[model samples]
Each structure stands twice: as C-alpha cells, then as structure tokens.
Target: MPQMSPLNWMSLYILFIFVFLIFNIINYFLFLYSPNQNKNFKKKILFNWKW
Candidate 1:
C-alpha cells in the first residue's frame, strides 16, 4: 500500500476532530432546547402506574 503524507494525515485527523465537535455541539443544543414534556415522556408513563 502507498504511504500517506504527513499533511494528508494531519488534515484527516483535524477533519475528524472538527466533525466530532460539531456533532456534540448540535446534540447539546438539541437536548437543551427540547420541550420538557418530550424530555419527561418516560416519567409520565411511570407516574400513571398503579403498582
């Protein structure tokens, strides 16, 4: 197999990191901005249980 140059390897690494950061930021805001009812959907189910 042919060897990768240092710049190519570095750019790939940086791109992977940048994408990871962007995904996490998007997830964080989604969690933050989601409605309270949506977040507590499971809790509401348990609250109605008789046991």
Candidate 2:
C-alpha cells in the first residue's frame, strides 16, 4: 500500500476538522433558533394532563 506524506495527511486532517466545525456551528445555531420547542412543551403539557 502507498503511504501518504505527512503534509498531505495533515492538510486532509485540517480540512476535515474545518468542515466538521463549520457544520457543527451551523447545526448549533439551527437548534438554538428552532421553534419546535414551544410545540413540544405544549404537547408535553397536554400529554401529562391526559394521564
């Protein structure tokens, strides 16, 4: 098997880390601003009332 150079591996690792951080930040903001929490709370209240 051919081995990758250290520089090549480092660059690939950096790129993967950069992409992962960007996606995670985007998902964090989406979750932070999500409107489903209100609906979920309402559902939970109604569910508890039924039991």
Candidate 3:
C-alpha cells in the first residue's frame, strides 16, 4: 500500500478549498449577472417568504 506524505495531503486540502471557493464565486456571479434572472426572481422569493 502507498500513502501520501503530510505535506502532499496539506497541499491537496488547500487546493480543494481554493477550488471550492472559486466555484462558489463563479456561481454567485452567474446568478447575479445572468440576463435571464431579474427583479422578478427576487419578488418571487420575497413573496414565498411571506407565506
């Protein structure tokens, strides 16, 4: 069996975290700037919250 060194594990963990954050940021921008999404989405969300 083979095992990764502690430094390799740490770097892998950091890379995973960086990728996760970048994915979230890209998703946020897509949602915020997409032309198909508009104030209607916000209004619908607020309306649903009222229930």
**lDDT digits (tens) for residues 1-51 of candidate 3:** 237687788999999999999999999988895456455554434456666
Segments of candidate 1 deviating more than 4 angstroms: 1-4, 33-51
Better structure of 2 and 3 per lDDT: 3
Model 3 reaches what TM-score against the true structure? 0.55
Q: Name the runs in model 2 displaced over 4 angstroms.
A: 1-4, 34-51
Q: Give per-residue CA lDDT, model 1, range 1-51, as digits (tens).
A: 236687788999999999999999999987886445554455434565776
Alpha-carbon local distance difference test for all models: 0.81, 0.80, 0.81
Give the Å error, residue 7, model 1: 0.3
Q: For each candidate, how many residue pairs have backbone atoms clashing (under 3 Å)?
A: 0, 0, 0
Clashing pairs in 2: none
